[model samples]
Target chain A: MPQLSTFYHTLLRGRAGLLTGAALLLGSLLSGCDLIEFSPNETRTPEAYSDLTRKNLERLRQQPNPSGGDTVRFVFVGDSQRFYEEAEAFTQSVNQQRNVAFVAISGDISDFGLIREMRWVHDRLKKLNVPYLTVIGNHDLVANGREAYQKVYGPLNYSFEYGHTRFVLVDTNGREYGFNGRVPDVPWVQQALASPGPGISRQVVMSHVPPHDLDFDPQLVSPYVQALSTAPRVAFELNGHKHDFSIGQPYENGLTFINSYSFEKRQYVVLTLWGEKEFKLDTVQY
Target chain B: MRRALLLPLLLLASLLPAAAQSAASAATPDTLSLALAAAPAAEPEPAEPAAAVAPTGLTAQPWYRPHHLILQTAAGQGLITAGVGYTTLRGRVDIDVLAGYVPSKYSITPMGIFTAKAAYSPWTLPVAQGRWQLRPFSVGGFVSHTASSGLNNSRDGKYEKGYYWWSSRTRVGGFVGGKVSRVIGRNRYGHPRTLGAYYELGTNDLYLSSIFTNLGGLGVHEILTLGFGVKFDL
Candidate 1:
């Protein structure tokens, strides 16, 4: 007995109510997933030592240093491909040669610095009968990356002297948390270069990101360039970030810098320190 | 009393002769066959009134009839996008805004959007009902836009800050599908309802494309929901 107008109004109201309810439910369901969004870690965690990290570093340090120094030739390579088996094969092949002193991986030891990559790299590097050293790369800074790097590779900015040559490795990834600076810890390199070991005849700096690479931090380049020019024992600088073979000769002051490319040539540089002030660059093919 | 009885008997006797004559004629071979045929024919003629009744089925309506609207949100590579869209038999149109986060300088401040886009579908098909009321297949077409925003940086060495708005994100695509529907209605106080399965493909909404892009490519996917309380004109 309802009037025609009343029936239409009731039907429309019911339809609208149902539609509005559906919209509300859809909105909530969609927005709920959005609420669980991912935010990049803003605060950087200081790389502190841990049991596993310390154990890994000690394992690397424990590898035997050869007794006699008869023209010690170490391979300086960086940015190994992602395949662990390929890298392990390369390491084993290099290990078979008896004259090689030690292997110094410039940086990007692990593409992501994930525990898996670090472990894989470590296990593969263990195949070598010689000692191996690594520097930190940009990819190693995600999540607990620095901690993982220091745990697996040791003090990232530390120096080591082997058979008259002093090698200074530093963290060049900078604070990529979108900080105000251009690059990271330049002063550390300056001090490291200023003080080489007692009988260290040659000094060389190695890092993942090259100072001359287009993707490099401009601010960090000047101070690093200054350190390279002033250091008396400094020979040629070795670097690998460009992923391709490139050489730059920056005539800043009096430093003749040689910026090496990536693992393209299956190659690394062999520096022969010819006593206190002179050295020779021999690009070794592995 | 005797005279009245006699009058009634006289009337009955007079009517009995005519009745007897009609019965005799009906029982004759030729007359009986004709009478039987006439009776059946008369009965069947009354059935003609049924011819005016309307056939019970769905109406021949256009396929563009849309029954729902959808919104999508996607964020990736330091960018976030929010979109609102309307779908109908005619077509669809959507507006989207993108925003980026700047965590270094401040937590709350967004670097703003590097890109923003708005898309409009000029023509759409009523492919939903094609697989249902008609055969099991339908097709449709739509033209759309997909713009990009340029990037900006505040300082030479630091984080970039700027926005780029793209003009031409236009594209065209088609969809083909089948739809099936079922109506549920209780006669008590409400109208009937419809529910069923439907699939559409084409140059779809940008949000769907973005999700598919994030997933690698557009393949098979599902967005299931229940619809009730629909109205129609007879």
Candidate 2:
């Protein structure tokens, strides 16, 4: 009882101590709420960080195309996993570029597929002057990343059209699923590409693993490539995972696959597209 | 960035001396004598002679018998965790085994996390005439394995060995914490029966690797996780 009385007397002595105590309590409470994580693999994220893909797309719709004509210009990058320093510099570099409609990150938003990692990447990318988009990569699909990605970034396969260009992004990290063969969702890709609507002119496919890579599902490669090759007005397929820039027609069917530079590469691609199947690629060093 | 990393260390360093000072002052002979004088009157069941040497001799029970029960939440363990522990090394060290549960709402399926942890408390300060005690600092480490029916295997012969160097199901982490306890009664062994509340700040191996690789990019606080729990001396 005496100790209790003494403790109360000490607290009553100074306003600064009381204020410091109150501030510490408040700070711990706020940070504690976030730090009370169930597991690193937990898919749950705060509302502010969830459904980011949909939110970014919505934001993109509100801004008029920076490049006025029928041309759509965007910064293309990928594999942001664990490259926090690079992400910040990349943002600064992309923000300086003119006529960029948005930034498209092909995949691997997080290295470990952890919710915190995704949030960390978003913390950097959210500073962009233009909203950015991402597709799921093999690393993003690790552990419970598929559900985490779905919660934080919306569907794994989706298409959005802007400035007469239709962008089809899908999940092509098949090895993560043990090469389940159902991934890449070929039917969904075909459907998304089948109808570009009256306003759509050129179609572009984007994903994480390029079909030529061994990580991609070998069984679905034929059908997946055939789906893109036959899609109307399709310009090319863009991918990440390779961590460097390369553009080539690896298939006998004449489909051009363009690999993006990972964030660590200190480089990114700026693509300006106009008319059906016509596009220009420019690399920028951050 | 350097300042940010140094801030937490400075805060922790400042706290240690203040706590030690309070404990040193509270352990004065006057308080000890007063506590000793009041012990027998309040708890007649505890033998006076045995109570005098209880700190070292309290663990006369079987080695396999646990000395405390614990219930905790979060800290990257699970939604709810329950466990038992053995206290030894004059109550400075404790080894615990816990089983944690996370509902399906947080994952593809309900997860059961099993963890074994060990902690060392360098100081225990009795206050309020032995009615309360505070352990201002404790450092510990834990290893946990998560089991879920629906969790995809990171290494189920799906790739060549070392494709993913880290195991998805197993995690090893370390934590620092403090506890405050109130003595309610005396146990059969003439020891103070106490109930304590504690909080821990911790980070896992993966989080450490992320920060180590990107020291300038990630902040130390971003990797931390907090957990709160209660422990009862059995």
Q: Pick by TM-score: which candidate is best?
A: 2
lDDT of 2: 0.82
Model 2: how far is B174 from its true place, Å?
Answer: 0.8
Model 1: per-residue Cα lDDT at residue B11: 34
Q: In order, what lDDT does every prediction score?
A: 0.45, 0.82
Q: Give me the displacement of residue A5 in model 2, in angstroms.
A: 26
Writing each residue's lDDT as its tens digit, candidate 1 over A1-286 gives: 3674465454334432333244334434553331121122111122321233344346545645443542346666777634444465567667766556777777776543333345545656767766677777765654334555655556767776666777787777653334435354777777888866577777877787766654466666777787787886787777766665555576656565555435444666655555654656567565
The clash count for each model shown is 13, 0
* Native contacts, share recovered per candidate: 0.01, 0.56
The candidate that wins on lDDT is 2
Give residue B153's error in model 2 in angstroms.
Answer: 2.0
Residues B1-234 of candidate 2: C-alpha lDDT, one tens digit per residue: 233234334434543554454346556534323333453355455566465445542265544446776778788888888777778888899787777788888888887777789999999999878867899999999998887767766777778898888888889999999888766555445677666777889999999999999989999988999887777665
